[model samples]
Target chain A: MNIVENFDLYAPRLINKKELLSAGHRACQGCGEVLAVRLMCKALGENTVIASATGCMEIISSMYPTTAWEVPWIHVAFENAAAVAAGVEAGLKGLRKKGKIDDRYIKVVGMAGDGGTMDIGLQALSGAMERGHDMLFVCFDNEAYMNTGIQRSSGTPMGASTTTAPAGKISSGQKTWKKNMAEIMVAHSVPYVATACPSYPLDFIRKVEKAKATKGPSYIHCFSVCPTGWRCGSHLAIAMGRLAVESGVFPLYEVENGKYKVSSEMPKKLKPVKDYFKGQGRFRHLGEAEIQVIQHKVESEYQKILDKVKYLKAWD
Target chain B: MAKRVGMEVAVAVAEAVGQCDIDMAAVYPITPQSHIAEHLSDLVADGKIDAEFVTVESEHSAMSAVIGASGTGARVYTATSSQGLMLMHELLPIASGMRLPIVMGIANRAVSGPLNILNDHSDIMPQRDSGWISLFVENGQEAIDLSIQAFKIAEHKDVLLPVCVNIDGFQLTHMVEPLEFPDQELVNKFLPPRVPYATLHPSKPVTMGAFAMSDYFTEMMKAKDEALKNSKKVIIDIWDEWARMFGRAYKPVETYKAEDAEILMLTMGSMGETAEVAIDALRAKGVSAGLIKLRLWRPFPFEEIRAAAKNAKKLIVTDRAVSFGGPGGPVFSEIKSALYHEAHRPAIYNYIIGLGGRDVTVKDFIGMVEKVIPYNAEKTVDTYEFWGVRE
Candidate 1:
């Protein structure tokens, strides 16, 4: 394994201690999305320009006169972050080729939330990836539209209550499965596609580093836990992410050059999905039958990744 | 030395953009605007121009990509028409508000209920409030000249705003005419490399397009408005410089045979030439008919409009797009609003004509003047009518 893959051993020495996203602006207490952004920025370092979509991260970090971004950043609109990043990449390349600017390799990154990515921004992202711009798009999937007060998004998990898909006398909350954005990006045939969570910072940082080194398009789907949106205690945010990965609800994996490799170690007997849903109020309305349905879906999804890793030959 | 060549207006506009030494262009193909995009793609593919040509999937992405490129301090260009322009409407204000100097070519076409891909000002009429510096061109030569001048006007330090050069679709964009191509050396001398006010650079970190709330929203809007209003001076200065360099003069409002006329007609875009021909015919027949061509639409050219119409007893304004339930024509409404407070305002009449590529002949212009000659502004029940509409 490379040094970044084995970064947990030499993290203090290998990591750049400089923080790109500054401290103390307006992120909620224990906001997993902001935490994931912090780790990703640390891996990106100073040689990066970010195009951020209007979301929780953009709102918290940039508020008129103040800003928390230590590197270059821009927020164009809600659904065009990927398209903007592609423009930045092309602009830089054009400038360098004409000797207008220095030929330093600057990584362009697109950042958005679940609603911006899986829903409104999907077309722009697909076009950018297909065109093969050297950029990274990181979707901070907090399940629902946390920025808009717990509205249901395509990334929202089934049976999870939201403002638009609330559990009532007749409704059982979100009816659809969480969109598999990682697989959707993988289907674009990009150079790198990965799933990560702030619950495992080293693993998440390692994936970001790999994506940064990627020549063409790279996508990272971050499973960010929203304590406020999920109607859970803020202190349990990290713990909830841990529970999610351990219960196989959100598997950690990476697809490099069409080859699948599971990043996290799976238990011989995976933890039950009920354990992941116990503290979250969004899933509290579900009965045993609903829990069983979720549990079955989680097991099968995790098995699909495992099976792909086992069956697919390594591209290298 | 400038050289005159016969070429299609759309291709000439693209070639003019190439002469500006742009850094990037992001365009999506649409009717009447596809030729510009095609030629630009070929220019980049054949290495004729040292630029990046981004073939975006939709007009929204095309506008968004150019915004991003301009934010990164790249000299950028793009083209679209009608439905494509409507798709780009959301980002137009954002581009102007951020003060990104992106220059775009608009092939003015009719918007659809029944889908017509032809010449009209309906495409650009709805974007009046988009905060862009809008310029209308009459023919192929003006199309090429304005396409080159748009970059210089947009990138001026005092006027760092997006500009749209509107050419009538199929009327001017598809027509072949002899156009004078400005020399590269002169264009380079006129338009230097862009020095962006603020750019996304790791060396100097800055935040662009930040969220503005009630505390600062009004102030931000005020800044944008002031910038657009102040751009008129810079626009005139650039036009003066172009005239001195190329011997082809342009103005916010151009007049033809209006010096000693009692009756004047106003027009925009390609219809200006037809109206001028009509004026010549009226003058030969001993009628005091004149023409006022409005080249600048965004700033409204209030002073120029008043100056041109101050001596005339009656002014007929022809519009190619209807303003729906509000007013008869969008241009007529604007001119009425502009002349409302003027002390020496002429009696203005509106004629909504040439909609959806309905050909406006020279005789049609003559007919409008004759139709409105007998009516008095205060006594007439309806001062505006849809001309040439089948009864």
Candidate 2:
């Protein structure tokens, strides 16, 4: 946290030289998930045991006989990253008591994809937070099951064309709205919950440090862009993330204990939602009416967040 | 001084585990196995034993939590039965492959289609090849003895794998019997403090349960297989030590009235006690029948099975769980495979019996032994019939 600086709008944010992920990884070109993870690992330096769920991050980082992770990591089944992480936390607590080992500095982290965290692993994630384990769970939200060939996930945005929910003659794309996983973690009364994007590495790093500082369970939902799945060029990943934030589509915010505050700086007014949607072909099928509907929903959700911040700040 | 007290087997098991000085327990409530979880939580609440008790949401989480805990070099325990055991099917191998040495209690019950929450081996049969040390207990005393012994066996340096103590649901778990409570002093002497070889630590980190590619995957599987196979020696050693200290002898195979018998019957878990009664009745008649009770289910006790069947002309194997569409039962398939290369193997007949808590009387055992005696079991070996099954 002391080392991390504010996001410099005029220039690039300086990333740490100590790379936790190795030089060679199997992630696709312009894979924002790995970039987000690079920043995350920089925040949670050594002395962290990461229990990664089965998904793109796990698959790319750990190909047997080789691994990109320098830190000690484990990949159990898909639905139990948080559960396994909780076990690791409990295990350390027990070992410290019986083995007479000082493990105060050791931290456990759970990492999963949008499919793993929001869908298959939600129950384990919720249970871990409810039990109040000292750990961090970061959901690498690529919005779909990119590893399984662009299948729609619960975190997949509405109107995005996926393998399961294809853009058809009668249908626009995915019919369901994306699940609010950050709010779900917040409802668990978690000590810290935040939403950050890879495009904003400084904000992402600071939040990871905040979660690391929290005494109990903490969660970070990192909005990751996938060029291969989002039907964009490899270089457009960061631009997609920026357009998402600038258009008010994916607002960066944090909920500390109970109080809510938007973490990322917002402009005087938001750019049109069309600027964000037009970059990716997944939303190319959306008509003017569908675009308006999405814009209206995103604006309303953003307003709800603002109203909560205002009311909570009034007490302060 | 240890004293004998009448108590339910499940409670006795939890008490035995509490005496083991375990560090943590993560378990879910499942039918027939609920008593173990309930009593363990009570023990923790009463502060009789100092441990972290977590009531997980599902059996899957229970196993996962135990794996996590065990990976950190903590002595851990958990229990489940039937569907609960079935739910943990995916993580069973991970516990063993990681060499975590977790001790789990399986209150053996039938898996469902008809959905019966009663005594059967279906629960643990599916986990036979999960590279865990499996022991079946016949009664409350065996349950208590084996539950305590499981931790020692699993934590044995040479056998750094998971151990599962299987007691038949409702049959052993629900029954009350007079059992000797080993004071912490005796348990401490017999089962010394566990020394983990490696654990998750911030100081000296180690990667456990790492992914193995094709080049090393086969070797990894082989190593795990070898570990489980070699655990047989450790299991026998712990039983011998327990016998020397407590004066209750335990063996992979226990026999009753097998002296100069031409016909033999094999049973596992709680069914062994019932089959002994059948042997006594058959001896009352001129029929020279004997009984062989298998105590160790995994590692198969091949040498013991061969010796037990050496003198007998026929062996009637009874299984409570079905293999369905292939073999008559899981135990039967293993017996056939174990005795496949015997130079003087006896005729083996498998009887799928007492499924889903259907009561199998002493008369049923006598009848099965007699029915197999009439047939030339040598020709009938490797095949089976469903005993007491409707026409």
Candidate 3:
């Protein structure tokens, strides 16, 4: 049995080099979401079926008569990727049990953007997880409805300017904090729940591989930097994702069976949230007062994870 | 061997569905629709059916899950009604456009305003343009028969469109009736295992439901429309084969005592039976009242509709759902549109009846026909009215 073993970040050669999401696609330059999708697909490989929600990845990867998907992929609609994946998993099981198909281990994957996951898609995702379907749901968190021209979504971070929630003299950007989707999946008591960033390529790949091996529902919330929507330099997309994790605004962590583990080693003193927001034009209007408020929230949330890690530590 | 058994219409419908050798079902429980889902769940639990029964959170997910399962080359099924159907409205087009052969049972109920959960066609009426093969069953026997045939019709290569077998909520679905269950071996022989045109498999990768811009959007819609239009022949073919194997026969626009009648009353769903009784009473009263039961709602059955109304001088179109501010009731408008170009067409009067499950007895049907009796081809009358509304 050729099973993907525990991955080592130091050994790049150990990773599967197959490009399941092929080239000739129309994603923007330095689009971190597409990069994350590409990396996750590499981890999933040929023995997988992806049920993608209608969002940026779906549009860019699949246009009629031409497709970047080298693997079997279905784009159903927004808000139902999890439900669809659950169905796919169940369908495969049914077919295999009926002896209509061989019992080869084909992973069922559901992929969606933040808006598709945290907001409109939440119920389906929750239902799928609760049902314990053998599938993996990945949320590419660009923090807004980027595919619909940077509209504010529940996933949009507080004070982040979007087309719908523009920062003005009379008003701040988005009024809500970024929804903790990975934590929400954990609440569903799924076997595996993780937060990853493609900038940490090894970590992202490893988590996906772990999800692939999982027998029940698994969810991964990926921090996908959007250069175009965020009004940041295209080149800073990867750096932006790394900054998101390092600044404690978005942490690299995993929860296994109700136990939490912070994947990345946090600095003794976390970088100020302003440092994470500095490069992006979306947060350019934020003054010290607003930044301080966001900074406080980030620190407290990050500390909550640390507290969970300290007390609930069970796995290595 | 087939034997008659007394069962609730909903339970029998689920049993009929189970016999289809379906691989998966994702259903949500809603009023008038809960029995189908519950019974199907029991069937799966009891090992009566080898299928995955996903009790979805909402009807939206139910439709989505079925679409996904069907895309994986599995014979999939689902059930919903009224508000549930309304909730599932968005994914309806997606399912048909993707051409997934999924069969669903809809215990028809009125869409809410005052939140009524009784029998009505308001639920399935608005889904007219969803590109699905829609069929209305008049009774328990038809519900069971049609539910089984749905899989065969939907999975047909020519018609890889989703099929919704609509049975009136409470009126038909909740009724206990003696219905014959076809032998499992015979059902398997009649409705062969689904042969999916394309599927999500590792060996053969395909991208379905791709983004289509203006350059290709119209063409994609045209293809879907053409596919639905072409599906009529396959539907008839399957029904014919079903009739040959079993003893029951069905038609898109079925008529009852309409021969040489001047006045024809049109009805859909379980109301057709009542309308028949009304026709008998009207004939006894020396009125030339007849009945036309529209069994197939989608792909509209235009030719059959026109042919059925040809000999009639006046057509009384009864609609259970209000089109609200539009041209009378939905079915009434459809009937008018279907007969618009014909040089010698009947004068059609639309009666919007049974909104939110108001009882439409035989007397009501007789009254509707009698009200339309005063009109003739030469003189114009009110095109439509809310039948039974207080003046």
Candidate 4:
């Protein structure tokens, strides 16, 4: 049976009563970034305003006169979305002081791609977190700068093929490992930090809701599989994302005020990282030796994360 | 009671910030502008000012923290110079676009390549188009006075925009001068409580700085432009009110010895005083040179400039900054544009001088006048030229 024919198997009912990200966006078909955004907006509802950085999501959603965003949305420059959101949040509070606005539960959220989050926007994000603004920051990690034609970004995984990090005679693609942004955010000692992937829609939605409920500086790092950059079949987007988590490549976890909790633990021996890498063309050039090295690294990192959670629990 | 005290312009600016009801100041010290932030930090630490003072890692972070603090409905301030100002260039536009009304002190310094950190207008000249109200203060008194006025003007409902109070690096920012410190109660009366039009509040939430689509993008820019243009009139009214209360007047262009004068010298910031000395010397020689100091840069005093230069036979425009391979300087081009369509316009000449604090002595000013007079006599003055360059 075709995938659409088996809709009951794959199609989850959208529970978000409010539609902040409207349908008919100009995002490319099967764009995982927009899917993540849709899920986040659904979780945030209409009471939130979003400040978006300049990227593929912003370009496609806001096309002059018409916008895919049902909520109040602003697209600032690539690196200053966090700062702009801070200003909006400040402006809101100032207005409230004068009793100009009626009291209502409202949230300010900032959304940006990996290029914006891990690189150019790092300082602004850190400053906002440090200031303890009542805000939520969401980073959609697509591994590469897919909007700018698949250039390499700090978030691009090691040995991954990108336009700038192409596999050739002198080098394996993307020599550097992906930046540990979740850990970096947790180090800021903010109230909350969590990692989620769109492959598990419910889990991603739950994290957004948790971030919204948090009082100050909640960060949600979302892993979004980019079919264009990953060189994977569009149909396998969700499957690849799922495999990444199941193989312990990208663990689902949350850190609350320096306390760690691993939400999904691998019970049996996790699947080899090779199983996850073999499907994507970005990792096609990896030999068996390199694959073994990647697997070892993934397993070791996963253990360290589990140990952190255990340590925090022991102290508590 | 108001009291006269001798203070550096940078110190005056710090004092102004200290006396204001500022809730927070996030700053990273940079050359020529460090004194302002340093003094403010000391004041905060000494309990002279009750404010959250953050010493940030970089200019970018300083601006970011200011944005964050300002979002919390706190009055915010910061300062930077030269390349530090360039690093904050991206944040400047964002601050204004979001209409946060952040009041900043910019010590006008030359931008870097060979890495010179002395005096010039290059640093702020590039930010002229960044949707900020630029106020050029001539001395310590104006620096103190304008810094206080900036907060009031920026936070006005119709003029909700960021303001940059520019003081010449090393010249005005460093030089000590006597200033009349306004009484605290009088200041409190003149500058009412800040009522932020927008802020982050749990109750009655409003969306600001929203993403604009192509459909609404033009309208958004138009709205900002309309606010800035409308602010010009508001600025005039506020300055008038300030004069009424303080007995000291301010205008977009302040004229001195211009009546019945045949030659006019147009300048900004500390160079205005230098030009005044040159004018006085020229007048002593019966040369009929007068001075017009530009107090406002953004919302470019076009009408005031036109009226100021209307009676002059020759207008010599001096800029401490250059516009690269384009015009002689950024201000010169704007002044020329403002006068292009006027009837019976004076012969205008552009000169780039005193870059990187290369001492713009009265002799240099007189030399500029000498070069302009011959060109005016022949009615064949070149539009622009570098004044003191080796070439």
Candidate 5:
């Protein structure tokens, strides 16, 4: 038997065995964030550095003197991941000019949860994007601030129950709709922006791969189903993310240089929004009226994406 | 070899920093600090410097972006004023704790309550414990000189802490003066390219700014403290080298005719020049008055302050920032705290003056000395007083 039977390494392997994100992370039983990050690492390979804002991922992966990251990572402040990524990009540029780094340039990735991206970190995200840092900002949206005990975030969906916005007497839980992070990134006019989910492993990897390939700033809004935060079964996290797309609640799409394309194949008629909402206890309090309202809202948002895609398709 | 050119202090600062050939400059505009950012932007756009100039949405983002850029092992610069500085307050400690050697310019302006935008030490005073080495300049030449030196001080391996060059708002930032712009080759030789301790590089991966539990937090804090406390040696070294290369000299505590004076007056920033005029006037009248300009605000010159105050029977500390409900002013409280344990301490008196762009003249300094004579620094109960407040 040959010691290295699989020595056809000349071909670009789609499934890299070298896990840069690595194991031994302190993530929960069925963490969608870790899975997505794992795939992201697998896509970028070893030539990458990550700037993570303070959140679940930061807390889980980095401990003093013992880090889960096999690659360079930094967690500076709560709201400045994108800003710090901007700095890293500039710093690398300077170092590269002086021939201080390897010729194959390290890819910079900024990671933050929904709260870090949609609320406190919004200004920094906008500024980094506007400045066009040659980096990628990947936002893991688990609906609420999961690291802070499931508090409502700007990305929390309307009718979803969180610790702060619980469904109690005379309360309909979160009154406002979830912030459209992918559309927001599109609005920033970044070179590449996309919606991704860990459930769709290939799609997630493909988008992340595209982000690394794009020259300027790129953003990926990955839907991570937090079982602990969403009051769902630990094993249902992956299925939940799939439902988020299959039911048209979180349609998988991409925007490239102002062109929108729905990457996930949708049926002529998507399954009822209730199929996406019913499994989670956070939305168990919803009545027929509330469910209908959510359904309508989801339909409207999904239609907007479809309209953009059809327009771009027609133009092309 | 150098040539003298007359320019605004802010523009001169831009010129000075430009000579450093920084990698990136993240800027946000606020009044009194606007000209510095505007000029730097122009320099970057016009290819005067091959650096990145990012006009961020806000000062908070400016600080954050610079932090990011600096983390990438890039030489970075930024500028801000009053409310802008206040907005950047949260991330200031993070930058220092991470040991990122980013240089920033503070056009020292008063903080707002009634929304006044003018010159004062109010803006920089509250940031004493933010883990940044602070320096103040007395004039346009000093402004230009120190802006360049700030980067050197900050980038020192022993003192890899961020440094702030606090230039008085419109008083110094707007005024024009002649300064000798040094040769770029000389600057390149003096300030070498940065050697980052650890950065975001995939070649050799390491984690930075990791969360510290109680077990490790104390040690981290102590390391930062020791790095700063020991930085005075580097600061003195940089100043000495600069003086040799150039003709101008600088010191932590610069004295003006204090060699044979009993009543020593202390001031910081541009007020030092005006206080020097008052000292000349006092000497002419034979009142035994002298002036001491405190150039370094952080790593507070405890020993120098004691030695200067040792010979004097009385010392008057003129401050520009109020501490509100506690001590009368920030500088006054700091000096008092420093002198509290001294064996032979002078009768110290503090007067809050020149706040919110209010000017203090030579006569006001002379008046301040007269006011300090009545109150004994050791024996008196009421040591704090405000000067030139309208009735």
Candidate 6:
């Protein structure tokens, strides 16, 4: 007579609850990009079809005869993920119209890197939103073109040392500021647009859930820390991402059809930008003056974001 | 069975679209290709073609809209030229890789730099390797015919790939000719509705264009390769069926008076028709020369080319576009590579001619034939030579 005799020992347990991303993948250890994807898929669940642009996420998950994706997926090209996703959504609608498909709740998601999203894929993404397709576009931002070696992308932050934006005697690395993709999405007047980071998983998950719940087009820009390109330990990916949010370097926020709302609030005594920049090799070459300039820009942008949230809240 | 008269090639293409079973046409107008989109838009407005006509902002959006519309398993069509085609270049491979059977009419024009809007093959040549089944049409009738055939070829399950029907910009797209419009019933039987793989269905969901790690990237490419390679046979079958139904036959390589010919002239697009005039003149001169028109540029008619060049001692391949800094023109290099293993490969010489719509007269063709003489006499040829260039 054992304690097991007092209860049912062989009850079927719900072992695997994770949706979207499946277990096996080729992403490097502690890769933040895949982690963001995992969370996105988890929130999206199984009824979502993904149109992926060629990037690290695509390269790491899909290989010949094998895929880490549990759901149906497509890898179109580097710049047409949004376009392909639109096609999938349209195809889905056409199938529904013909009574060939019954489920109407299926989600169409497009995932691309910053280079794909902000540069090459921008027109397609803009078109999709303008067309008012029922889809979600997710841009996994690693700042630079990490998949093709550390080349500069439109989203690469100023003072970051990428291969294309190498610091030299005559010039500072990535002299331009990151492109405001969230604002660009808002310009489309899409139903939803949000910014999230892996550092704040719950907020990111919530934003995705809200996006899935919304109609028409929605965009989520997720800040994914690239340890390889950033010259940091893989384990520090999450820490770096957290620092980005805590330092207000990358703010957590959402915009609902032009209504802005900051999701995470920073303390008045937040860590300096240098504390965050010093952790990554990309900003290792930044001098005091450059760091000061970056800090000023970040502070100004963060205040603007805060003001927008306040104004929207007051209007609402 | 309805009859309507249209002069411009774009209007004729629009008429064809109206007559066919197309569900949607997404378009953004560019020079030389605008008439087709505009006419299609008019048809959509007039309730002639029951389809969604999306006027996108850019060529990129135009292609993107079509991709979305086609993904929904709808038979889709679009048109673009030169700079527009270049702008949509990034999406061409995606459309093919996703295996969406989208057909586009591309007006071949010279690319920008000099900002010319005239006819040439340079615009479409760069897209030769983008995994699309490229078909070159010489005139208005062929334009109408190929547009219809393009849909059938693209939607074929065995050949589920995108297709680009190349027509010379001002030469064909702006010209008018009598085209025998096919019966609606016949077209319906021929094309039917598109059946796409992995369409977004709510009940049984599927994913397309998924992220492939290195572990499986090669296999995804292999799948596309296999599909494209297999499409050659399906294309031939479709062409045969089309010929049987419409009494107009199309081959990957169409030969004119090639039997027992000693000299063969190869060309593509509208330039091929010009070369035909030269072939007749050369025949009159007792040169025993023939014209071989390359109809399908991709899935390149390697076997057909080899067979056509079998009896020839000298093959003069005239490419309208230059491959710059390379051996010969683009087409010649491809032809040479294909015939490299053949036992009776002929002496092939490449001539770049009629770039930016330079008038290629029968004399130019004769000059090309004359230039091939030294190569045959010496049993050696410069890989390529420019024709009609001042220098």
* Candidate number achieving the greatest DockQ relative to the actual structure: 1
Model 4 agreement with the true structure over B271-340: per-residue lDDT tens digits? 8887888889998998888888888998888999999988888888888888878866888888889988
- State which docking tier applies to candidate 3: medium
Question: Residues B59-124, candidate 1, lDDT per residue (tens digit)?
Answer: 999999999989888999999999999999999999999999999999999999779999888999
- Alpha-carbon error at B240 in model 1, in Å? 0.5
Better of 3 and 5 by lDDT: 3
> Alpha-carbon interface RMSD of model 2?
1.8
Q: Per-residue lDDT tens digits of candidate 5, residues B314-375?
A: 88888999988987688888788888898877777888899898989999999988766666
Tens digit per residue, CA lDDT, model 2, A1-316:
3343533442244445677877798889999999999889888887888888888888788777778887778777889999989888887776676655674678899989998999999988998889988899999999999988999999999999999999999988899999999999988988789999989877888889889888989999999999999999999988999899888888888998789988746655888899999989999999999999999999999999889888874223
- TM-score of every candidate: 0.98, 0.95, 0.97, 0.86, 0.96, 0.85
Q: Which stretches of candidate 3 lie over 4 Å from their true place?
A: A1-12, A313-316
Docking class of 4: acceptable
User: Which 10-residue span in candidate 1 chain A carries the lowest summed lDDT?
Assistant: A262-271
Best-to-worst order by TM-score is 1, 3, 5, 2, 4, 6
Sorting all predicted structures by DockQ, with the top scorer first, yields 1, 3, 5, 2, 6, 4
Clashes of each: 0, 0, 0, 26, 6, 23
- Per-prediction interface RMSD in Å: 0.7, 1.8, 0.7, 5.0, 1.5, 3.2
lDDT of 6 by residue, B1-391 (tens): 3354556787888887777667777788888998888899889798887676666668886787677667667778889999999988987887888888999999888998899898888899888878899999988878888899899899887888999999898888888776677778888888777766755444454555554457766787788888887888998999899889888898899999887888899989887777888889888888888989999898887889889989888888888788878887888889899888988778888888888877888788888886676564337566677776677
Per-residue lDDT of B89-153 in model 2, one digit per residue for the tens?
A: 99998888888899999999989978998888888988988888899988999999999999999
Fnat of each prediction? 0.74, 0.51, 0.78, 0.26, 0.73, 0.51
Q: Could you tell me which 10 consecutive residues in candidate 4 chain B have the lowest summed lDDT?
A: B200-209
What's the lDDT for all of these models? 0.91, 0.87, 0.90, 0.82, 0.87, 0.82
CAPRI grade, predicted model 2: medium
What are the RMSD figures for all models against the true structure? 2.5, 2.9, 3.1, 4.3, 2.8, 5.0
* Candidate 6 i-RMS: 3.2
Per-residue lDDT, model 6, residue B84, is 94
Best by TM-score: 1
